[model samples]
Target: MDDTLREDQKLTVRAVLAREGRGFAEEIGLGRTNNPASLFGLLVTAVLVAPRGESSGPARAAHEVTNRWHTPADLAAASAQDVAKELGAAVEGVDRGDGDDSASDTAATLVALASAVSETWGGDLRGLREKAGHDPARERELLTALPGVDDGVVDVYFREVQPLWDEVAPFAGTRALRAAAALGLGESAEDLARYGNRPEKIGRLAGALARIDVEGSHDEVRRTAG
Candidate 1:
């Protein structure tokens, strides 16, 4: 974002960003809209992507689910079986597993999550934020309590929504931090963010770093940067 950066460092970042400059939320069409519905979509994506080996399948499932359900109330109204069908269709060739119950189980958990959100927060995730009092640790604890949400989900959610949710801005989880260190971008989220020169850009940088890690493109990115 400034001329102070070494040319190689800027090139390395640009190479990675060219592949995926947007956070997962934005990649999935949720675009920093922090409304209840967009929050629901973010939650859906986090839940789907957590613990997954590759992102494509989970991303597809999330896209299908969010495209169908605009709100927690909408998702809560749907049958778990219908949601299962959607999930199954979304990842038809992804080989998440041959297990027949996988999609069904995920559907059940998601439906329960939607119901909990609708009942507890009156279909608004902002209430959860208010309850957390803008504390990241408290927010993580509360998110982990949601049905089907785990630490991995919380990490993904935090990374993707940091731009929109100032309460957790500039956050980089384990994957992003690891990628940053590997790319000579420093060991901390703040260090990685410093390259962007804007707080919101941290989410984009973090997401791009995570992608490099997941896709095993460290050498390629480094070469491009050089």
Candidate 2:
């Protein structure tokens, strides 16, 4: 993209993110004062906890683990079986889909993310958090180290947590893609990325798309295309 176009896209993305962030914060009853680590843990929990039609049992469990362990590394140190057992206990009434896969995946991601932060960046996540401020590439790399976490997950993590780190223009994810399509931005994830990863633009697009109550809305359909 040209410099001018890139700048415009970024502005759009920022507008979208701001809107989405506000909605998400309100949904979860979180205040703006929460830090990145806190938000990261919360988001990760959201992933494990909130699949379609599911309540937030996994999120609550993950939060408890985070409170007790203090860091991903601390959680990572536990045996997979132990982690699964703990998570299962925490998410008591909810069916976690499979016996151990969910817990194992969560533990693996946490450990790998922690390890990547220490080995690749020469610091714990706390130290490497600065990468989001200085280098988006490094931030993406660090995020991808977590098992089962794809571009979508990474984008979500960055978008939600970036504000806590005092960073701007964190990447957009599926929600952003849907939003952009609603705003007539573009059709694919590639197109959205090309538009810049500003939160507000992405958030606005998503919110508009999500608000479509009509059946057969293109924005709603686009969400299932991937």
lDDT for every model? 0.80, 0.49
**Model 1: residues >4 Å from true position, as ranges?**
2-4, 92-99
Q: Residues 22-122, candidate 1, lDDT per residue (tens digit)?
A: 76676666645779998889888888876673366677788888889889999999998778777865553433343557777888888999999999989
- Residue 211 in candidate 1, Cα distance off native in Å: 1.7
TM-score of each: 0.91, 0.54
Residue range with the least summed lDDT across 10 consecutive positions in model 1: 91-100
TM-score of 1: 0.91
Q: What are the per-residue Cα lDDT tens digits for candidate 2 across 1-226? A: 3254544455544444443324333344444345434554645554453331123355456655555555455655656655555566456453444566656666565566545544664434445557566576776665666554555555555555555544535344555455566655566644654543455444334433333311224433334332
Model 1 alpha-carbon miss at residue 191, Å: 0.5
